[model samples]
Target: MLYHLAKNLIMILFYPLFRIKVTGKHHIPKEGPVIICTNHTSNLDPPVVGITASRTIYFMAKEELFEGKFFGRLLRKVHAFPVKRGLADRNALRSGLKFLKDGETLGLFPEGTRSKDGKPGQALPGVGFFALRSQAEVVPCVIISDYKLFRRTKVVYGKPMDVESFRKNKASAKEMSEGIMEEIRNLYEIHKN
Candidate 1:
């Protein structure tokens, strides 16, 4: 309920206020378990994609955010789970797989955290792991440029890529992960206006 309410309210409130323009809406799949991977820019990037997408995006949030009583509940309601950064957060990983197995879409930055300079960062191997484990098609996404007033937000939606194919082709785990990140980087290049 919180996800839906916050999603609708924030989009109505901040979209016009921020003048946030979204493109490539048709690229998002309407059903099934899909992974939405993008480069993390600002703190707003998560919700920006979450509300804009037509599905409830189950995502991993920093563990500290869920420590707060009031805020924790709110985050949980919105399909956000806390994952320990820099260490294995097994619980968080389990939740992600569960959501996907349940036929829900999951959102991941692949870059791991918000970029300090708002530039694309190196993506983590966990993204590749999940894609391989879940066998879900990855929807490569990019948020171009900054969020300053009148700054254009060009989102490029690339065709879904096959993680299994990469794995089957004898690509090492790191190689496959880098391959996924490279795909996102290429899309970023196109949408970076």
Candidate 2:
């Protein structure tokens, strides 16, 4: 209820002003636990990805962004939970797992932070941990926008990548993360100019 209300309110407030286009939405899994992993580029990325998806996207935001009193509450109301940056925050991880156990979708940026340039950046291994622990399907997405305008924004929801088989590969944690990151880079390359 809160998520829908917040999304609707946000759409009413911003959609008219910005040029928005959302594609590849069909790739989103309709039911059960799923993680939508995306590339981070701008402050606009989370809401852009969240508002575009038909359902509420419970996304991870840096703990720093949740600092302001009013805005922070508003962001949380819309499902932007905070995780400490530069490392895995246990509380945030537990919260995420709990949400999955409850059958909710989580939107995460494996990169951990915004890309300095509006291009693909190295993704972190945190996603590997989520995949290992939650056993949720990872839905890949690349939100393409020219950084200046939201008008030409095209959030490409790529094919779902199953990390289950990869789990049994007996790779080290770092290897697993790099493997997931490799797939992410593939999608990034496949979609870019």
Candidate 3:
């Protein structure tokens, strides 16, 4: 499959340039509907996180990346879908939920965009909405690196957070989002050396 092939190729290329290291991979569920909430720091975040994960992660990439004919096709082949930034993209949201409902691993950047300062930012409420609607275990993941060539990049996957209780309590989307981001921040603080 293109997904496997691309992952392999990317690992071969990135491992050398970034000296990528990974930990807490066991936190990722071997199988089930799961959501991975990660901090966005660089464009490399996607591939780096994907390479470190044990399972395939379908990501919500920005729409601009899919504008090109060939690159768009390739991204789709690798299970990455486009999301229109700066708006509530219903189609993108629906696709993400559908993936989770089907028991697939969905990767999300709760911050919605990359942080220029490499610090975790407040997560968008959309990730919380999806967590409540799908009831999937949300795992906090963080990638620590300046993403410079030859620099070491560490990717850590934290224990999954159960949001079913929040859903039962009728927690607001903003509350759930804050919880997710808090976990990500905790992981980053612990691992960011």
Candidate 4:
């Protein structure tokens, strides 16, 4: 499959180029529906997390990436789906939920967009909506680096947080988003060097 092939090749290629150091990989559950929430830094963040994680991840990419014919098809081949930005895109939300319901791994960037300064930012409420609605375990991951070529970059995966408690407590979407971001910040502070 294209996804697997790309991942294998990237695994080999990115190592020398980025010196991709990974930690806390065991924190990712081997099976079942799970969400991997990470900070958005560079355009390469998706693939970086994909190859490093033990499971195949279907990501929620921005809609414009799928505008071109060839590129759109290629993105699909790699298991990336388009999501309209700057508003609540229902179609995109359904796609994400369906993926989770089918017991697939879903990768998300809580910040919703890449950070120009490579620092974590506040998350949109979408991630929290998905977490609470699907009752999926949310893993807080942090990618530490300036993403400079041929430099060391660290991807740290933190333990999965059960969102079921939040769901039971009737937490708001914004609150859930804040909690997830806080988890990501904690992981970043601990591993950032």
lDDT of 2 by residue, 1-193 (tens): 8888767787775565566666678888788888888888888787777787756678887888789999899878888888888776899999899988888899988777788887767767787778778867778888767656345566778777867777778665556566666766777687675
Q: How accurate is candidate 3 locally (lDDT)?
A: 0.92
- Candidate ranking under lDDT, highest first, comes to 4, 3, 1, 2
How much is the lDDT of residue 103 in candidate 3? 91
Q: Could you tell me the lDDT of residue 56 within candidate 1?
A: 82
Q: Is 3 or 4 the stronger prediction by lDDT?
A: 4
Each prediction's RMSD to truth = 1.6, 2.2, 1.1, 0.9
Per-residue error (Å), model 1, residue 191: 1.4
Q: Whole-model Cα lDDT per candidate?
A: 0.80, 0.76, 0.92, 0.92
For model 1, what is the C-alpha lDDT against the true structure?
0.80
Clashes of each: 0, 1, 0, 0
| Predicted candidate 1 versus true structure: per-residue lDDT over 1-193, tens digit per residue | 7778889998886676557766666777788789988888888888888867777898899999999899999888998889999876788888998988988988998878878876678878778767877857688887775777655566666777877778688776567667778988888777676
Identify the leading candidate in terms of TM-score. 4
Query: Residue 116 lDDT in model 3?
Result: 80
Where does the lowest 10-residue lDDT sum fall in candidate 4?
A: 129-138
Candidate 1: the clashing residue pairs are none
Off by over 4 Å in 4: none
Worst 10 residues of 2 by lDDT: 145-154
lDDT of 3 by residue, 102-191 (tens): 899999999998898999998899899889889588999999999899999999999999797788788998899999999999999999
Better of 2 and 4 by TM-score: 4
By how many angstroms RMSD does model 1 differ from the true structure? Answer: 1.6
